[model samples]
Target chain A: MPAAPVIAIVGATGAVGVELLGSLARRNFPLSQLRLLASKRSAGREMRFRGGTLIVEELTENSFDGVDIALFSAGATISRRFAPIAAAAGARVVDNSSAFRMDPAVPLVVPEVNADTMQGDEAIIANPNCVAAIAGVALAPLHRAFPIRRLQMATYQAASGAGAEAMQELRDGTAAELRGEAFEPKVMPHPYAFNIFSHNADIDPQTGYNGEESKVIAELRRIFDLPQLPVGVTCIRVPILRAHGMAISIEFDQVVDPQVARDLLSDAPGLRLVDDWAGNHFPMPSEATGQEDVLVGRIRTDLGDPSGRTLTLFVVGDQLLKGAAQNAVQIAESLLPAH
Target chain B: MPAAPVIAIVGATGAVGVELLGSLARRNFPLSQLRLLASKRSAGREMRFRGGTLIVEELTENSFDGVDIALFSAGATISRRFAPIAAAAGARVVDNSSAFRMDPAVPLVVPEVNADTMQGDEAIIANPNCVAAIAGVALAPLHRAFPIRRLQMATYQAASGAGAEAMQELRDGTAAELRGEAFEPKVMPHPYAFNIFSHNADIDPQTGYNGEESKVIAELRRIFDLPQLPVGVTCIRVPILRAHGMAISIEFDQVVDPQVARDLLSDAPGLRLVDDWAGNHFPMPSEATGQEDVLVGRIRTDLGDPSGRTLTLFVVGDQLLKGAAQNAVQIAESLLPAH
Candidate 1:
């Protein structure tokens, strides 16, 4: 790789794709040239980037010919078809899709948690499910200090995880709801105005876990390197636009003090402590939207665990940025040679 | 007491009070007379009840005259001041506030769970917290069958739990948000439009549990007749109008089959089953709003517990009805001679 890499952002017209552009520009990433690629429908669309307009081009097999780093934010089908081609063309791929996440040969990474796991020579690095990525940032520090034995999570996911259209669905449906007008949902299977439902992902009849919940469970285990780590999560979509929030209970191998865990999280990279007992303040999605750092708070010993080995925390992160686009960009940054 | 009791509703203009009137009407409650009482501000306001408009009378020391049963839905301050007065005035009081909930002498009842705890002669009966009441209904049958060993909950509470004004605040703020206008929240501590926040209840510095969480913990233990039940709860307010939803993990004394739990819940009173894995349908706040039964679903073995003794459920209930008004009316019904 050269001192400045030629970067390409796949699905540039989508939600995370737009954020990917902002992330690269905001970080002032060392990119020799930038290419924006999307579907045929979105091709030729102009998007503002770094005080200039970049035209979206239709993605083709030859799109990554001279690109050194390719960020994939399109869905899994597109990633499955094109990521390997990009990789074979000598471009390192950071895929923000489930296409290669669970593959044993690929490293599913939350850069803050497992950047070193990236061998640098791998064809593609996988970004985890949004819940897994957000939770991993907050859980990794404590899990490292005291090995985690069990995990429980209840998520308040946002519409952005479903993609850009769902975010617009939330806004439009909410406006219609306020006007006492009927809205037939087009993107979401259920109502999206001032309401919440279990994640729209199809449920696995055998396990009773939705597709999103299953992905979070498997991806978290991979990211933590705890192959057999038990995880239970309920994924629900609230009416918010972008950020996701969750209540997580982490059980360690032995009794752990909440204050000790709080101290550890305070200094952890990619985390900002928002826990304030006196102010009745903790991680909130309204504050987490558009922010790079995951907000971690409500840190306390789990009252559900009699042995006192568990701690409960509330975490919030931008589903588009930290959970997808920003993390994918960070993985590309790890390929740089300055270090 | 007379064959047809004289029922008095305290704070009749409030959210739960309005629902209390509807609950009584829908059940065709036997009553000789109905008295509607409220604060001086709401006094003289006309509210439709049963087919006629009842004029709200200012609640005073003498408001309970000739009243056989009094249902209180005002805040704790009013309950603390007026509940005993009504009791002393020869009325059996069912209070929907926290004033007397933790009192050893007061029976904190979810009628479906612990109706027998209230002796007909008791001066006052306390209703469990909204979350506790809704959870108690779904859990009582399961706990009776398997005996719960541990409990953990993460709540998606509604604006109605705070009261009528908060609900209006949510609608107003959300409308302003849709219009791209500014709205300073008047009732909630945080922005209420398309946002979620930790329950605005004051935090208990020592335990890091907010007031709502503490109430659920204490009240659930009281209702379940388990003094030492380890309970952990996180209460959050989503932007929904009335119904509250929660994801709960219940650890039982032994390995229990999800099918067995499903059978028990299907037959349980005050609950409606909504678990449909294939159709991707589960309990949702939109469907639970104004519904009589607490919708329970998403029942499965908790993968986080390797012991196989834990099950997770998603529960949703109307915050104003079962959470407060309906439970209070049910307690009053248990006082009737036939019951």
Candidate 2:
């Protein structure tokens, strides 16, 4: 790989894409050249980069001709069609889509959890689901301390998980509600203004689990290398603009003290311990937005189990950053040589 | 008690107070007179009930002199000061505050779960917390079937739980956020617009459980008549306006089937089964608002436990109705002779 790689950002106009630009610039990614690529609709859009404006070009098979690293944040269909082509064209692809996450060949990675999974030779690296990535970052240290026997998660996800259009829908629908006007949801399936609903992803009839929940469950299992780890998840979309929050109850094989767990999380990379019991302040999505670390708090022993083998906690992280763009960028950084 | 009781509504200008008026009217509650009462500031305010406007009176020792039944939706301090005075004046009080819920003498009643606990002799009947009330209505039938071993709950509570001012704060804060203006939070400690936070209730320093969580746990135990029942609760305040949603994982003594639980809940009173697993539609605050019945859905086995004794479900209910006002009204209705 070149000392300074030529980087291409797919879905350059989407929410995660915008965050990718910011994260790359803030982290000072060593990129000799940066190409912004999107659909035909956003082709000529100019996005601010390191110190100047970069014109977005329409994504095509030839978009990765000279690119050494391609970061993809488009939907599954776009990534499915273009990621392989970009990889075949000699660019290392780090995808934020769910297309190749469960594939055995593609390493689904959370840099803080299992960065070593991605060797320099892999053509493509898959980023875990936003919820799974956040949970992985917060739970990895605890899982290492006490093997997680089971996990129960309920997610309060934001509009951005559905993409930039859904974020716009949340804003516009909320504005319309404030104005006392009727809002017919255009991007999201439900009226998202000051409302909460089950994730819009298709539900598996037999299991009654939505696609997003399934992705989080499977991705976390894969990331933790616990193939048989049992996980139950409920994914809900709240009216939040960008960040995601999750309430998690974990059962471990052995007793785990809350203070020890807090200490482990405090020292864990990519995690910020926000457990302030006296202040009644815990992880909140509003404070976690645009922040890199996953904020974790409300760490206490599960009240239902007197055996002291279970704990409950809450976590919040910016979906656009740690969940999507920052995770993919970290994977790309792992592929590069020492700075 | 009088044949046609004079009903007084304390805190008649609040959110739950408004719902109490609507519920009483919709249910065609028998009353010789309806008295609206609020603080001194709102004494002259008018509220429409049963076809005419009733002038709000300042709640005092004399407000309940001729009243036979009083519904209190005021805060705990107001309930603490006025509830006993009302009872002393020959009015039976059904309080919607947390003041007397844990009092051994005050029967904490969810009509569908434990109406018999209040034998029409108790001077004051206590309404369960909003989250606990919703859960009680949905879980009572299932607990009867399999005998619940433990319960784990995560609540997506609405702003109305904090009262009318908090609801207003949510709306104005959201509007300010949409307008790109600064919002100074008055009712809530956090910026409630597009944000989810741990329930603003005071946290127990030793346990890390907030007051809302503690109430739900304690109230559920009392309502279920299981003094030693194990319940783990996490209460979160979401951006929703009126209704509350809960994700519950239940462990039973015996293995239970999803169909059996569905059948039990479908036939249960004060519950509407909305389990449309194939449609990816479940209970949501938007649909549950103003609805009397708790919407229960997403019934499935807990994937984490292979013992087949655990099930997971979701429930949504209007906090002002099923969670508060309607429950108080139902208790008052039970006090009447069979008609």
Candidate 3:
């Protein structure tokens, strides 16, 4: 039997970190040994994976010894500090943070969209934002079906995307509000129960786009190499738990049909068409929160734009699944051809 | 004083109908006698007004007799069926339904924005969609500053826009899901909690826009008298209760400054400038839900579309108040300049 691959997971105690562990077990990623790393506070925590329990160790300069693949989800600060160290120790890093994404040398990737770009990595590959990763999969096939000109999108993001504490904040805040008790918001920037917050970040006094939204737009533009494409976006965080939804309107260079776009998406690997509007069936967070495939539905002619080429759709996906862990694993799956 | 005006309320038990009553009371509309009219199911309900109880009676041919002003909050079907009857009975009808909004002869009125043309003598005055009402408040000031040539808006509508039962649907459906109960959705076309749905109504074969969204765009154009202006819109229903928020991008003939726009809106009536991002104080649904004025905020220059005169903003308002009831009552307040 062949020796299993060595896998190391940084930020193992975080939200995306937990999802990474599950995706490993679900995909059954060949593993000779699993190493868990986290901040000093969370380093000693014990977690269950499949049948065995794993103890997390504090991530440090020398933590990547004998590691073949490192998954970084500790956040941009931790990733910025530790990712280069891991890559220098000869481990290929699948970084699920924004730290290295815009670096000219770093390849921002969604495996299904750009597996080829990950091949010549300087050992550290970037995972795009959750919304971008899911959108890329759906857009890749359609961009191939019809050359595009511009895109406009609005997102309904989930609480989980903010982190574990934010999710707890939503549940606790809502429960407390129900009980008529004071709910002091700790993790989230604002009340997280029944409200939506705009994400175009406070205009940077320089760049207009919020940090999060700018990353998605810039990464999509870079990933698709469409430097001049017009992308208009408004990102909103909602009171949902896991899945994020985007209302997308596309204006392609050539005219496109709803059926044709639907067929292209149906044939795409990373997407599932849940669009039977007549039956009140379409992409929904409740259904897509744990699913690997991005749900794209409500496809129709863009009434706002003329020329049959414009389309409007509702796209939804689990922020943890396709948005984070699953995409990282799929990238690792690309490097090692053997299942 | 001369004989006070006799007033009637149609669909007295509905969400907007209730607000209409409260707004009338709060604003102190002088009424010598009041008649509450509703369907047979809600006809016998009793509503208190100004320390007095008014019994809701069945809306029939004689319901509007001797009444000088009738406020209609029923659905479009009822409004379509009875608005003319009330007008023929010598009553000025303020119909809060889509049935008369697009009617060429019927004037669409937003007193603060279009009080000049609110001749109101068609005997039937129409109300725009809730989202449109809020959007109008934000856009009117900007249009005056720049003469808007085109508009692109995406709305985050609340459940209250669907009516009292839909608000109940969100509350009940959400509670049901929490209790692990099977949710039986009835009020909305789809489930109303923890989910978002599209507002593009079933499209007419001849026109591409949905019934609801089309009404908004058409009504906006008619009220603004920008008949040739291009208005592209996509409306989404979110899991909020009473306020509706819209993300709008406009192209103006002249340059738009976020600061100057704020100054103009600061002076504009029935509008509150809530765009202070430094304080993290943009208008949100929770803040706007119960407020009379539509809160306009998140003001910024459009980063894309090199034309540079474009501005983007988020506007939120209480669908029940400014969007429906208070708006109709405000028109009535306009008729009562002495108040």
Candidate 4:
């Protein structure tokens, strides 16, 4: 790899795409050139980068010709068809879609949790699902200390998980509802005005779990190297804009002190402890919206477990930052020769 | 007991108090007279009921003298001060606050789940916390069949639980947020616009569980007649208006098929099965806000328990209806001699 690689961001007009630019600029990533690539409709758009304007080029077979590092944030179908081609064009591909997350050859990575899984020569590095990436940062510390026996999670997801269009829909729909006007949802399957619903991902006929829940389960297992880890999750989309929150219950093999778990999490990478009991303050989507750290708090022994073998926690993270763009950027950073 | 009893609403100007009037009129309970009572500030306020307007009277020691039944929903402080006085005035009391819920003499009741716990001789009947009443109706049927070993719940609570003021705060805060204006949160401790936070109830220092959570655990145990039933819960306040949703994971003594659980919930009263797998439609707060029955769906085998001994469900109930006023009214109805 060259001293300063040419970095390319695919799907550069979407929510995570915009955040990718912000993360790269804020981190002061060493890059010789930056290329913004998107669909034809957004091809001529100009995006600000490093105090300069970069035009978004239409993604084509020739888009990755001289690119050294390509970050793909488009949908799975786009990644499935183009990631290999980008890799064949000599770019190290980091895909932020579910297309290759579960593939045996792909190293599903949450850099803080499983950076060692990445081999520099791999054709593609798949980013874990947003929930998996956020929750893994908080759970990894405790699981490493005591080994999680079982995991159960309930998510309060935001509209940005659906994309920039869904975020605008939430804003528009909420405004109309406040004015006592009816607004039809065109992006989200359900109304997004002060409402909550099951995730819009297609539900599995046999398992009864939605596609989003399944991805979190599979990706967390791969990220933790626990192939058969039992995980149960419910994903619900709330009316918030860009942050996701989750309530997680983890059962350990033996009794573990909550304070010990807290101590471990307080020292974990990419995590911040926000547990304040007297103040009645913990992780909230409002506080985590633009922050890179996953806010972890509300740590307590699980009252549901009489054996003192379980702990419950609340975690919040920016869906577009640490959950996607920042994580993908971190993986690319780890692949640099200096690391 | 009279066939047509005289009824009184102690907190008639508040959210649940107004709903109490609606429930009485909608259910067409046999009432000869209705008394609307509130604090000094709200006294003399006119409220509509059964196509006629009733003047709100200031609650006093003499308020319940000729009243056959009293429904109290002002707050825990008001209930703690006046519930016994009202009961002494020969009015059957159905208290909606947390004052007398755990008292051995007061029968905490969810009519469909455990009305048998209410003996006609009791002076005060305790209406459970919103989450307990809503969850109990759905969990009762399953626990009766499979005998629940443990339970874990994460709640998406609405603003109405805090009172009429908090609901308005949500609306005003959201409107201000949409317009890019700053709004101070006077009713809620935290920002209420398009955000989620830990339950605002005071947290217990020892357990790190908030008062709301503790009430749910203790009340659910009492309602189920399982004094030591292990229950783990996290109560969160969401941005919705009037309905509360919970994701519950239940562990049974043995492996319980999801289909069997579905059959039991389907036949259960006070519940409507809303699990439509193909439609990706489940219980949503918008659909549950004004409904009488609790919407139950997303029933599946919990993968968190590889033993197949656990099942998960998503339940949504109107916070003011099934959770508070309607439940209190149902208790008063059961107390009538017509039974």
User: What are the candidates' interface root-mean-square deviations?
Assistant: 0.7, 1.1, 2.7, 0.6
Query: In model 3, which regions exceed 4 Å deviation?
Result: A1-3, A200-202, A306-309, A337-339, B1-3, B203-209, B337-339
| Candidate 1: regions farther than 4 A off | none
What TM-score number comes out for model 4?
A: 0.99
Docking class of 1: high
**TM-score of structure candidate 1:** 0.99
By summed lDDT, which 10 consecutive residues of candidate 3 chain A come out lowest? A200-209
What are the lDDT figures for the candidates, one per model?
Answer: 0.93, 0.91, 0.82, 0.94
DockQ of every predicted complex: 0.87, 0.81, 0.45, 0.92
| lDDT by residue for model 1 (B1-339), tens | 777999999989999999999999988889999999999999999989889989999999999999999999888999999999999999999999999999999999998898888766889999889999999999999999999999999999999999999999999999998889999998999998989999988988888999999999989999999999999999999999999999999999999999999999999999999999999999999899889999999999999999999999999999889999998988888888777
List clashing residue pairs in candidate 1: none
Candidate 4 scores an iRMS of 0.6
TM-score to native of every candidate shown: 0.99, 0.98, 0.95, 0.99
Using DockQ, rank the candidates from best to worst. Answer: 4, 1, 2, 3
> Model 2 segments beyond 4 Å from truth?
none
TM-score of 3: 0.95
lDDT of 3 by residue, B50-153 (tens): 99999999999888889888999998999988989998998888899988887778888887678777753568888777877778888888777679887777
The number of clashing residue pairs in model 4 is 0
lDDT of 1 by residue, A42-83 (tens): 999999988989899999999999999999999999999999
